[model samples]
Target: MRRRAIPLLVAAVALAAAALTAPAATADEGAAPAATATDAAAPAAGADDRHRPRLYTPAANPEAYSQALDLARAGLYRDAAGILAMVRTPQAVWFGDQSPAEVEREARQVVRDAAGATVVFSLYNVPGRDCSGYSGGGANTTAEYQAWIDAVARGIGRSEAIVILETDSLALIPSDCGQDDAQGTKTAARYAEVNYAIDRLEPLKGTKVYLDTGHAAWHGPASITPRLVKGGIAKATGFFTNVSNYQTDSANSWFGKLVSACVAYVGEGGDAAQCPHQSWPREQADAWIAANVRTPSYQWKHFVTDSSRNGQGPWVPPPGKYTDPQDWCNPPNRGLGARPTLNTGDPLHDARLWIKISGESDGLCLRGTPGPEDPERGMVDPKAGDWFREQALELVRLANPPILPGS
Candidate 1:
């Protein structure tokens, strides 16, 4: 579910007052205007793109990129470059509110702009999204969602891409969240919508479709495998885990392997009822897989994990601080996880990591408190998708494997 935040009217007023007190400057204060054709163009800035795998770069993250440049001009090179590097990594482009034509056009442009490089696109138009809570809106019905997905498929039009189909669609089922409406209709149209997307997208040349499986911390293999099967995982390229959440890579990878093994088990006519869970001891789980799952790991359903924000693992709230910690919501001290890469060494692991969620955005943390500010941080968190300056800086500074020079 999407995190919720309280309004920060007090902070807004303070910021307004500070802005009024500051000295006035020209529109292009820090950087000069672009040079005209008559003037020789300056050399293009150097970027460390060689080692990085080709990921779809969004047109630009204006606010975050601008702030990074300002910091660079101020001689904060480490901080500046860190932010700049993040923009280079491929991130998902969500197509929720677009018309069929608009969505197709946008998708075609994105794939074409990628220039044959692999890009990730997220389809998030499931009806009754988020149980009608935060991030509530989606297509009004399953048919609408199918049409939207069809437009997206047409947009890609044979371009090589990875489609992360309908985040939280299966993981946050109504039964799990105590809201049967998530099932959509008695017939479970949610599964139908997903299957439709897979059928439409999987046939496209060079396209890989990955259904959402929530995170390791949320659903175990036994629980999610049946959902994946029902949602048509057999036809998909695979599934994705830990999207937009902060779960350690080891945990996610382990969970993914279990889920994959379970899928294979069920495919072989074995009962998922007897599959080992994430809670089982590692040795026990491995033993079970070795004995029961006859398929090669690579031949089994592959999976990828969202390693965008799990570097330092999850944040630990001070004991007794709040009645409910809401740890996943824009938690403090969390660092950037591993950078995006295709050569993950493990065949079962299609990719080591991905920026499934944009790192610069906030998570709408409320921390179980009511009111105008996040009680835990004593500040109002930014709404979901808004640029989070402080969090961005923190991610760069504490990045695991370090977002280093030329990296």
Candidate 2:
């Protein structure tokens, strides 16, 4: 069976041929001349009025924007506005497929575009990323990865950046996918590589680095806490969950708290096995935390959650479906989640981010069958990182909190 494909940097393409086309691009996604910053219309005028001062809107994809413009020319104003709403909003800028010098230049360009505002970078170039699965092709060796990190750090020198270090790096490793040796040499290198990244990037004057902890549904606190420790959460900002997966915000918050508490407990001479997990009854878990963890909230590690595509929550695949449901792979009918923000009320929760680009595809999902068509949708899905018009429309149409005001 194939592994899940997480979002990463890729050249955006125009929509594939299909009729009954969804929304067209807004002004931001239109054939507007390419620039350092986004030209798309925001919810309101001015940064302060539209959202917090921290949000950094990046440039939109020309091809996706042009497709939206065509829809608008045909009187698809509603659809065009919806597509515009997605690209204009502040989301992470992915960096992985570039050479070290190229990445440094691009990273520096983003910093200049932010203009003193905070920006999110989903850094996904860890060696053997996605277990050489759908989104493979990272650096060939650990040394190469270190050089890449060095360039990224230099690019962002003295600029505000929220670094979402390597998605699925800690959660999914070589050992988990049968890609490691008997002595687990590759797995050990993976840990060291993550630690090296933390050591290099965390020290930057204006950078805050968060490690990956997968999502709430996949790894509970007890299981992921130790991995976070092994991956160097002690010297980092914290961990991020639900990067390219759909899990409700409430669930992600609760899971984050459990992991934070477990990390504190283990740091203070407690065993990871005894820490409460997500599966424990709420009352029982609360009581356990009350009795054991005495660390102040501020001192404990903080976390962030991805709200980009959790608007409708996770899809429930039909019973007796395919042998492997592949629920995370472009599941049908998912909507956009909450908009990205820096003011999450919970101290332990850092921000609700659109870590995954909302409109991009999650690869050609096979669902463990021979045919190329996805049985559920009756169409072959787009390759990962491509502009998935059908899925993009579904997201806009079903977005939670409504992508447009008064919609």
Candidate 3:
């Protein structure tokens, strides 16, 4: 039997058709203008993942390693949509090497390369790019944030884009900054912010949104579920776990299962026999949920991932270090994992995306330039990411038969 399709019950959404490319495009699903960096609405923005050591993305196309994207398209079914970030604090500015023009060109190339398939993209520069502050952060007001979202909307509005919205905003948005640590106000406001975001985003067509639920360690079923509800999961596609950080796929699965259970339970009433809209009866509820708890089809088709640098899973904590080990910063021994793609099995899970690209280091590593001295490299490792690209190509090729160069 065919697996169930993820039904994105968005409260509000929006879509854009194509860049001046309407003439070159055909009907797929989404509507909007061609997504260009400039097209991406401003503020509204923001946005790791898991360890499978799976040789997936680059393995599909050896050519990406040796050929131009145009030439490599034949063999590679998909490619990654690396981090597309922006800042709106002092003013609007993008945060990647490729110029806005280059970013737009490559993004469109991805659209063309995929043929009719979907390309999963992550828009991570939401005002507060790094919730922790420091890099690519902003938007003190909701209106400012919405303006940013409008910009992102303009960027991908035109395609059948599967977007993973802010990674852990649902679990983090704080309400009042004035209070001396009022968790209640902070969480309450996050709910409102996310809900408003969904309303703004739903306007776009064919866009599947996944809210951020931090790595498994950060939350539990009861905790995340409430946040998800507040974030408007009822209207969203669903919530995504493990973005930017690292947890094994097995660990992520366990976490995902618990959250899914909570979602079912939340929607289910206590009196199973009298539960309204009861799809699975009380007796079968347990078994049914177990059987239906959305196992990620090996299809890995429905999801998107950042094969940017995960060849090796997260930084294993050194023997004794808990306080900012700096593993998140560009560390040694890291290789690229899966590339970004649009085939996620669960509709709620837009795509296993490379929201965080490797080229852009998280910050300084344990050994590298320790702070203050060299501020130029906030989190960029030009030399490091280049080496991983080769590894990425190898992995992508392994997953999909190597694409013959120039084919």
| Alpha-carbon lDDT, every model | 0.72, 0.81, 0.43
Per TM-score, the best of the predicted structures is 2
- My TM-score estimates for the predictions, one after another, are 0.83, 0.88, 0.54
| Model 2: CA > 4 A from native | 1-52
- Candidate 2, residues 221-333: lDDT per residue as tens digits? 88888899999999999999999999999899999999999999989888889998888888999899889998876899999999889999999998897799999999999
Query: Candidate 1: global Cα-lDDT?
Result: 0.72
Q: What tens digits encode model 1's per-residue C-alpha lDDT throughout 1-407?
A: 11221123223323323433331111111111111010011123464444334555564456665666556556565566566555544566777778888899999988877776666787777876766665667888777888888899899998878888878888886555555654346237778888999999999998999998998888888888999999999999999998878899899888988999999999999998889888899999899999999888778999888878888888888898778787777888777787665656678888744545545555567767775687766787777777777788887778775654333
Candidate 3 local lDDT, residue 298? 30
User: In candidate 2, where is summed lDDT lowest over 10 consecutive residues?
Assistant: 1-10
- Per lDDT, the best of the predicted structures is 2
lDDT of 1 at 145: 83
Ordered list by TM-score, greatest first: 2, 1, 3
* Model 3 lDDT per residue over 1-407, tens place: 11221111010010111111122111111112233121111122231112211111111222222222321233222322110010000011122234345555655555454333344555454433345443434456556566556555555555555556765566555432232154465455556667776776656675666677776656766666766766787776666776666554545545665565666556553222221222234456456555644444332212233333454566665655335655555445554444333334444344444455433334424333454422222333433223334333333333211111121
lDDT of 3 at 137: 48
